[model samples]
Target: MAFRYLVGRGKDRILVDTGNGNAEYIQAFQSILSTRDLTLSKILVTHLHPAHAGGLDPLSRVTWVSSPTIMKHGHSPRGFPNLTSIKYTSLTDGIIIQTSDGDTTLKVLHTPGHTRDSIVFRLSEEDAIITGDTLVPHDGAASVVLEDPVAYLASLRRLDALFPKLAYPGHGDVVVPATDLIKRSIEEQMQLPERIIEALCSGGGIMDARDMVRRLIADAPEEARRNFTGTVLQHLLELEKRGKVRKRSVPKRVPSAAYEERDPDRIKGPGGLTLAQVSKLVKESRAKDDKVYGLKPVEKSQEKGKDFSGAESGKSGKLERSEVVQLHPAHRELEPLVEVVWSVV
Candidate 1:
C-alpha cells in the first residue's frame, strides 16, 4: 500500500510519498482517498524509496514534485510522462507553504542520511511534522537513517529547536509529543559516530562499514538488530563519503562466503579496505572467538528544568536509539554492543 496525506491549510490535498510500483499499490491508494472523498492536487515525494514513491504511477493528473536531490536520480516509471511536471523544488529552510486550510510551513530541514535529499517538513500551525525516513518511531525511540550525518544532525537539531507537537512519518503511526521524539532522534544519532570513533581510538582502529554494523548487531536487542544494521550502514556510508573512514574497494560488495570485516587487521589504519577484506577479518576473528569493537552506549541526560523532564529522564533524545538496533542478516555477534549503544544513547 502507499502512504498519501492531505496536507496544508485548506487541507489542500497533496499526496506525500506516492508509493510508486505496480498498479495494485496505486489502486489501493486511490481507493483509500476515494473513501475520504478527496482528490490529490499534487504529489510531494519525501524521498526516492520505492515503497514511498511507487504510487506515483497511478496518479495520472497530479503534479509531482520533490527535493532537487531526488530529481537528480531521474524518474523512470512508465506513467512519469503523464505527470504535469516532476519538478525539483528547493525547499528553503524555514520557508512556509500556504494552503487553503492554514499555512503548512515548509521548514526545509535537509535530513540527508537516509538519502541525499531526505527532508522533514514541519507544519508549525498544525503542530505536526512530516518526517520521511528521517525519523522512524519504534518502541518509544526515534530512529533515523541518513545519507549525510552532518546534514541529518543539523536537521534533527532544527526539529528539536522547532519542537513540533507531533510527527507523521512516511511509515507507521503518528508520534504525539513531536518535540520529545525529535529530541530523542537527535540524541540517538549523536551516539553513533561517537561509537565508531571510539572503537577506532580504542585500538579498534579504522574499520569497514559492515564490520561496524556487525559489532553493533551483536549488542542490540533481537527485534531491533535488523533496523540497526541499516542505520549503522547508512552512518558508515556517510562517514566514508566524508573521508572519516576508507573502504577497501571503491564500490564495495559482500562475498557469498563471509559476513563481516575489520579495518585494522585487513587494511592499513586510516587508509582503507574493501568489504571482502573486512569480511575475511570477520571470519578469522570469529574463528578465534574475539569480540569486535562496537558502539558504546550514550549516557542519558536529565533535563532538570523542562516540564517534560521527569517523564523524559534517562530517555533518549529526539530519536530513540533502542529502536534502531538490529542484527545484520549475516553477522550475529554484534547484539550486545547494540544494547549498550541504545542504553547509553
Candidate 2:
C-alpha cells in the first residue's frame, strides 16, 4: 500500500488489497482497523488473486475499486472467496482518487505484468508509488500468475521512467533507493534473451519448458520457480518477435498416451506442439457428439518441416525453441561458445 492515510476519502480510512479470507487473516486486518479507530469507508484491491483479494468476503462491506479485469473475472481459478458481492468501480489509467481535503490526490496507473489487472498507485505528493505484484522486491512476483513478459517489460520500463523516490511492492522484503532497484530489475529482465540463448546452447538438444527452468533458473528460490518460468517465457516471446526463436512443429499422434489423438486436449508434434492440422482434428473430434474420430496420422509421420499447430508461439500453448538466433552484438563472444543447435517445446 502507498499510504495508509490515502486509502479513503475525507477522515474515514480505507483498506487496500484485502489479505486472505481466512479467519486469522481477517482478524489481523480488523485488529489494525479497530486499534486505529478507522472506519472502513472503502477497499481498493490491486488484483483479485486469493492472496490479495481473499479477505473481500468477510471484510468487503465498504465499496471497492479495481481494474476492469476484476469486473470481468470476479474470482481466480482457485474459486476461493467468491467475489459475487459488492460490484467494484473499474479503474483506468490517469484516474485520480480524491482522498483528502481537496489537497491530496492519488493517481492510478494500469501496469499489467504480474497479472492483466495489476496496477500501481502513484502518490506524487509523497514521492512514492504503491506497486502491487507488478513490482515486487524479489523474483518479480512470478508464480502460477500468468504474465505477459512483453507487457511486463514495457510496464517495468514505464515504472522506471516514473521511478519514484520510494516504492512499496506487493510482496518481498522492503528496500531503499527504489529507483536503483527498478533499474536492476529492468537490466535483469533485458538480459534474459541472452541467458536463454546460453541455456539452449548448453543443452544441445530438444528442450521443454521444464528443461529450460532446470537449466536457466537452476539456483532460483523454490517459491520463485514459477516466476522464473514466466520470465523465461516472456523473453522467449520477445525473441520470437525478433525472429530469433521458433516453436517446434507438433507431430502427428502415434497412439501413445502423450500423443493419443483420442485423449482430451492431447496435441503432439515437434517439441510437443499441436500444428494446425492436429489442432483442427482435436477440435473436430470434440465437436462430434458421435464417437466417430478423424483419421489419425501415420505412425511417426511429420508435417515435413512445419509448425503443425500454426500458432504464433505462446498463443496455442507452450512453445518450443527449435533454434536460436543471435540476440545482441555485445554478446557475440558467447555465440562461438554455442557449438551445437537446440530446440524447446
Candidate 3:
C-alpha cells in the first residue's frame, strides 16, 4: 500500500508521491480533485520505486519534482515509461517551496538508504514531514528497507535532529510525538545486527537466508516475510562487511574437459542413467537397510527418449552411421555417477 497526499488550497494543489498505478486509485484521485476544485500544479516523488512513482505518467502535464541524483541516474523515465514529455525539476537539500503566504514552506531533506534517491519533505508550517517508505510504521514498531543500513541509520539520525512534530509515513497512520517514534525506529534498527548474529550462532555459524528467516522470524505474519527477508539480508551484508560472516556458493557437478572430449556424442544429448539402472540402485540400497532421503524412482511417463543418427569415420577410415542417446534436460552435460547422495541433517 502507498499513501499520496494533496496539499494546499484550490488552484495550487501539490501532490506528494503518486499511489501505485491502478484504475481505482486514479478514479479516486480524480474524484478528490473535482470535489475540492483543485488543480494539481506539481508532483513530488520521494523515490523511484513503482509503488511511489508508477502513476507519474498519468499526471505528466504537471511539473514533477524529485532529487537531482535520481534524475542524473535516469531512474525517473524508467519508473514512468509513458511520460514521454516530462516536465521535471531537480530539488536539492534546503530548497524550499512556499506552500502559503508569510513564510510557510516545505523543505527538502535528502535521506538516502531505503533507496539511493530517497528524500523527505518537511512542512515546517504544520510541523510534519512526509517520509515515503524511508521509515515505515509496522506492528507498533517502525522499520525500513535498508538498501544501505549504515546510510539508513544516518538518515534516521538526521530526521531525529529535526524533532518532527508529526510523521506522515508511506504506509500507515501519521506518527505523533514523532521524535519518540523516530527513536524507537532507531533502536529497532540497532538490534538487527545482533539478532542476525544470534540466529547464525544458533544455527552453528552458517545458515542460508531462508533457514535464518525461518529460525529468527517464524512468528512473523506471512505478509511480512518479504520485509523480514530483506532485513535479514541487510544485516548479513553488514556482518560480511565487518568480516564476521562469509557467503559461500553451493557446489555443483560440472563436466570435465577430458570427459567431454571422450564422450562428445553422449554429452550432446541427455546423459543420465536409465530408469532401470536407477531402480536397481534403489533396490540394492534398500536391501542393505540404508536410510536414503530425497530419492524417488523415476516414472515411465516422465522419461523422455530421443534417437540421434550421425556419420563418423571409423578406425579403418570408413564413414559409418552412429547412434547416440539423447541427453535429458536434467543431465545434459554431466555424467550420472550416482543415483542419489545423502546430506547430513
- Please name the candidate that would achieve the greatest lDDT relative to the true structure: 3
Instruction: Quote the RMSD, in angstroms, for model 3.
Output: 11.9
Candidate 2, residues 228-291, lDDT tens digits: the string is 5545555666676787766553332212232233342554454454444444543343233122
lDDT tens per residue, model 3, 119-227: 8999877899989888777652213445567887899999999988999988888989788878987887888777767765654454455445555665565445445
Badly placed stretches (over 4 Å) of model 2 are: 1-10, 31-35, 61-82, 139-146, 221-223, 250-345
**Overall local distance difference test of candidate 1:** 0.50
Error of 1 at 55 (Å): 1.6
Rank ordering of all candidates by TM-score, starting from the highest: 3, 2, 1
Task: Compose the digit string of candidate 1's lDDT tens values, residues 1-345.
Answer: 435566654434655676656766666766766677654454566665666665544564433332112221233222123232445554544455544345454455555655665667766667778887777675422134333556667877877777677888877888888777777777777777767655443333533343444554455554464555555555555665666754432211223322222232443322344444444553453333244443443333332211112234333222122233334332234334342211011
Off by over 4 Å in 1: 8-12, 21-25, 28-39, 61-94, 100-108, 138-143, 200-208, 219-345
Instruction: Return the top candidate by TM-score.
Output: 3
What is the Å distance of residue 55 in model 2 from its true position? Answer: 1.3
The alpha-carbon root-mean-square deviation between model 1 and the true structure, to one decimal in Å, is 16.0
Stretches of candidate 3 off by over 4 Å are 9-11, 61-85, 100-103, 140-143, 221-223, 248-345
C-alpha lDDT values of all predictions: 0.50, 0.54, 0.57
Each model's Cα RMSD: 16.0, 13.8, 11.9
